[model samples]
Target: MAGRHWPGAEPLLPRLSRSANHGVLWFGAAACIATFGGSARARRAALRGVASLAVASATINTVGKGAVRRERPVLDAVPVIRRLKQQPFTTSFPSGHAASAAAFATGVALESKRWGAVVAPVAAAVIASRVYTGVHYPSDVLAGAALGAGAAFALRGVVPTRGQLPAPGRPPTEAPVLPTGQGLVLVVNRESGSATAASALIRDALPLAELVECASADLSGALEDAAERCVALGVCGGDGTINRAAAVAAAHGLPLAVFPGGTLNHFAYDLGIETVRDTAVALASGSAVRVDLGRIRPGPEGPDGPDGCFVNAFSLGVYPELVRTREHWAPRIGGWPAGVLAAFEALRGKSPLEAELQGRRRRLWLVFVGNGMFQRMGPMPGRRHNLADGLLDVRVVHGGRTPGLRLLAAAVAGPLTRSPVHAAVRRRRVRLSGLAPGTPYAYDGEVARSGTELMIDKLPEALTVYCPMTAA
Candidate 1:
């Protein structure tokens, strides 16, 4: 292949081969995809792409080269202009460049088809450049690419993609069909991440809908007003904002349409709504489903406290402090960086919360209650597959001197019925007492102060929300 070169290809092909020396070109591509792709799927694709590349590179260097030990091809017949300046010293039986390129491309394709199409051409060029640079025989490049593709598939078996799992099986509910978004009022939080840009897209997609842009403080009043004026209520924000909107929608007997406008939209993504377009399509066709909402109320003999609802999760102890700290730093730094800082700040010099769970006294570092059953997909707790299961996923970490180590061990152990450091169970209702007066709690990313006693349970199939049933 190097003996005969075509016109106008020498400069580009040689540069491409050299740029992919140690997977630098692929890493840069992954960074760009994570930054500009804008959706959760795009971020997943970027992460998987880098992971596949790492596996492929490791296999080629450690196993492929050592096993074959083949000599490099002679460059006598090849033109010096198309040849690489620094020839590779490793064996030529399997090309590492080809393996990395193919692995990254295949991994990305498994997550997102559009991004995969954009990345595949570059990967193909990098694979061909290895042979064109007179570094390897054609057979070596082919074998390396096969191995790379196999690596991606093997990784998929260990960690299944989102597409491989079934969508959340929510019971279908009926709603009004608003083709142009008539009779629908969408309240947008201007302070949320990407919300300002999403507002413009929502205007173009659903022009007839009344859009109310407000700050975090005014969200409650705006949602209350919109609930009274419109037949269906819509919200564009993070989990906290969606929690408020869901409460108002349920009280007013109105269906909710959620447009993901926050940094990490846990509730919206769980409902198969990733973008404004997804919710808009659902509203146009009146496609929706009924899901359960988690509630926290006063105990039988406790003070008359106001009832609250959580659409995602409710937690006590260090988690509430972590959410508070993260919000404080997220404006200065980015979300991911702020979360790391918050974890360190929240866990430092913190004491465990002493509470009674179902009349049993327990000392815990963290207590988590999910709206529905949460399963562990990989190393961490993943999304729910059935939103109306009428079960609360209860997990707790026992008090320990090394809080960080205990939490890490609990996470690594996955969801277990019983363990030395942690325990997990599925319950219909949970009762807690003996909390210190004015104890702090967090629900759906919002922090609040609670009384000494609390009753936690689910309101099954109580809220109807717009979501595409066929969405992956």
Candidate 2:
């Protein structure tokens, strides 16, 4: 194994790391300080520059990780692995830490040619940390370095080669448009599920897949109607449409996919596919890996107990409000602005209800349970909260007013699970109560079923995913 059997970080960070793995992090850290650290003032400047590069690397990597959840070697069934450190919560995709270090070293090198010699060696050393620590494959480290350097150099466009820092709070620019193929089938959302918008996306994505416009007059007919074709199902709507599309695809065994055309394309990001172009190309070019899906049964919805199926995160409370808000605004503007409008729209609704999940009783303001992954920050890069994992990341929220205002603060800024304002709760199964009939509940992004009770459970390894850039 090129990657080593190293000691863990909690123990390693403080001590002279023992052998088992020696070359990477030890030398990497040493090189970083030695090459970058100079006279007191010069070293301070280098440290600042390095830190900036690291932050930039982490941000871009995080988004890409969410957008490209490459599976880790940990997923392999064989026993060639021995974890030397605490396993990261993330999968190994475009290594964030390494990329950041590489970018930092690269940036510092650009500042001085003499520094360049030292910087390149140190950057290479840092790349060694991941593989040497046994947390990443050799390939993982290399890709991370490449991405980090790219992001660092890219930031220069915003910050300038020698001056002016980049603007804060600027979301990543729209995904660069790509020339797509000429075959596409557009799914339209006439009902709240976004069949109509999907049709528009298909109009635009015609070069990608063959388009067939499908819509449910309402939530009830969408799944049955959309499942007719077995080709890859690409949804251009929100969680609801994705749910309906996924349910239809799950039953039909057709590959299900997504475009961020809806309220939140949690499934798309989890799969590491972004933009219609990203989705179109990935579906056309990527291979299929087995993945899990979530199924739900409603106590008394208009549909057969199964409210729907989900390939991404699902939740209650605020999530439903989030969807409802978007539904109200989709006709006006179809992107993040609709989400922003929806946040304010939710403020017109009710407060968190007291409820019981699986047997635990608690008062909550909101609850979030996801299938793919969850990051208030768009996609959680490097980790797929795999629907196939069979476990839902359940979160319970309470004590926040949905109608009070502050859209961003109310949307992702708050965690239903942890907050003095809310009770952080996690469970495998849940029974909800203390709400009115027709109280909106969300599964993926399907329209809220006006039901009083819901029955939910985790189904493991339910779906297969195609990961092209995957590594050990």
Candidate 3:
């Protein structure tokens, strides 16, 4: 009726609704726009939108529609010629389209405020079109918008928006004064991404510090040698390299300094050292914090043996395969794209690992245990606000009664929500057994074949790590 009063806009309104005929088409278009028409950050923001849409659609179509069961608005007053081309068959108390649009727009805005500004108007227009087409009441759309926005907020707890920061809480631990660059031994993995550049930056910032370039084979020896004579052990590499440094530092009773130089510098970022320059500042200021470390003991020796430590996270089952596939294809296709491909490949015909969790037998798709609570920041998991809390974040993806649909649902819904196939627990110790001998597992991004049993425990305030004063 409003469109009829404003005849000039009627033609375009229908066209817009038709373009978004199904929520999928509009979301696909949004993905394409994010990928091709925006910056890298915008592309990441768009993915969060996609995830929020999935969660909103599932919640609205299931609970929202089933609970209310409101009748659709009658089209008797609508002009027959102007009615929706294809009428919806379901009850219309809450509009699914409006829910999806609102969820996606809210999710995107959480990631990129600027991109959200661009998407909000379009989402609003889509919600309005539902009523203009005579399929929904204004009240129905309003309820749907609320549902969608709620879904987006729910996911924000598990999925971080782009460039997200650590949540505010207690102040970080202050550090005592120490040597800046003198007697500092910094090690770099030459093969790791941008190592040369990172090394140059580190040297420029800490000219008195000694820099050593080593390959994966020589890494352990070089670190041990450095720890013997140096006041501090520093490393610029990926999670795998950082894991090694942590082990050596712990054994030698030396403080560790890390610079983010790898594809995923999860440990370094958690320490508030995102770049070599940050490391330099931390070193000069002698700012440091004590953090806990995760230790994993296997039933029998395979490669890394019964004793090992992870500074970040540990995973078993399809996760290791996903990591391997991502590494193989990341250089050619890019990290995020490769991860998408890897996820599909890993999930195909995947069988859950049979294990005993807390003495209950269960079949699970993946088991992830983090050294400390790792929050969702952006595309990657975020830094732990309290690294020395001495707690482990254990997440399990269950096969449940049905594997395929349930697993897929949990993935899109974000890991924090309740699902038949997903669960998370926090503790200081977790034990698992009944694994086949020589099962492959990933810790801090490196895969290792280990024996059946696994014991995970946390060491409180195990190591001291240097970081910028601002991190405190």
Candidate 4:
């Protein structure tokens, strides 16, 4: 192939070969995909692409190249213009460039087929360039590409993609089918992240539906007002805003439609609703499901406390403090930067909370309670496969001197029954007592003060939510 010159290959192949050195070409492609690809799915594809590239590069440099000592192909037959100016000095049994290209392309494809198609041609060009530049043999490129694809599959096995996970376990429920979204009223929190753009998209998709945009302070009233006037209650905002909407919808006995307009729409994403179109389609088709709503109430023999519900998770510890700090700075700066700053500020002088958990007195740094059983996908606690599983996913990080180090270890350890620093359990309800007055806790990104005692439990199949039945 190198000896026989192909038309339009002389100038492009050598430059492509040089550009792919040290995986620069693939990294650039990943960056572009992340920035311009538009959706969360695209961002995930870009992340997976770079992660696969890293794995393939590491394997090729540390193991593949060392396992075989084959030298580079001689440049005698290759044309001068097609050859790379800086000849590779490493063994050529497996082409590192080919490996990186194939891994990135395969990883992206695994997440999103459309993006994979866009990247496939560039990857193929890089692979061809490896051989055209007289740096690797045809067999070497083939072997490397195969190894790279294998690495992507291997990584997926360990950390399954969103499509690979089981669908949310809520049972199908009856809903009013408004094909043009006539009977639905959506409340959009203009202060929430991306709410303005998402509101526009929702408006376009559901032309007949009524939309009410309001500030954060008026979100609850807006949701309640929308629920009173419509057959179905729809909300577009962050988790906290959605939590408020959920309570109103439940009270009004209306099916809820959720549009992901928040910085992180954990509940909406867990229900397989990523874009406004997802909820729109569900509303049009009357496709809906009943999911569990977690509640925190005043425990027995305690002072009267405010009752609240969370669509996602509830936590008491440094995490609540982090949320408080993040909220304080989030309005001044941006969400991501504020979160980073808040983490440092929240943990600096924080101490553990002493409370009686399930009648057992324990010193704890963090207490996390998920509405349903949460699974570990990769390094983090990911989505819930069953939203109505009737179990509280309880995880506790033991109090220690170094709150930062203990939290890091807990995150790294994933879910465990009992570790030295952390423990996890599943229960229908968990009680907490003997707490210091006005202990701060967070539910669905909203921080609040807790009373002396609290009872956390799940309401089985409580809220009917609109979600596309065909979604993965």
The digit string of per-residue lDDT tens for model 4 on 1-472 reads 8888678988787888888888888889989998777568888999999999999999999999999999888889987877777788899989889999999999999999999999999999999988877888999999999999999998999878888876666788879998888988989999998889898898799999998999999987888788778999988899999999999998899999999888888898888888888888888888999999999997554556457899889999888898988999998999989999998987898889899999999999999999888886111357788888889888888998998888888888854567888888889999999998789999999988777889999888889998898752
As a TM-score, model 1 comes out at 0.96
Q: How high is the lDDT of residue 369 in model 1?
A: 90
Best by lDDT: 1
Candidate-wise lDDT, in order: 0.89, 0.52, 0.78, 0.87
Residues 1-472 of candidate 3 have per-residue lDDT tens digits of 4335545547766666666655765577567757554233566678888888899999987888899988888888877666778888999989998898898899888877888898899888888888888888889989989989989989998766535565423234544344447878899998776676788888777878899999978999999999998888988888899999999998888888888777667677666665667777877787777788899887654346438899988888788998999889988998779989998888787777798877888988878888888664111245577777788887777765445565556556554644666776788998888777777889998888767778889878778888787775
Worst 10-residue stretch by lDDT in candidate 4? Answer: 374-383
Winner by TM-score between candidate 3 and candidate 1: 1
By lDDT, the better pick of 1 and 2 is 1
Full-model lDDT, candidate 2: 0.52
**How high is each candidate's TM-score?**
0.96, 0.51, 0.64, 0.93
lDDT of 2 by residue, 205-244 (tens): 5555555444545543644555564344545666566666
Colliding pairs, model 1 = none
Over 4 Å off, model 2: 1-209, 215-235, 257-263, 276-286, 300-305, 333-338, 372-385, 400-419, 465-472
**How many clashing pairs in candidate 4?**
0
lDDT of 2 at 27: 38
TM-score of 2: 0.51
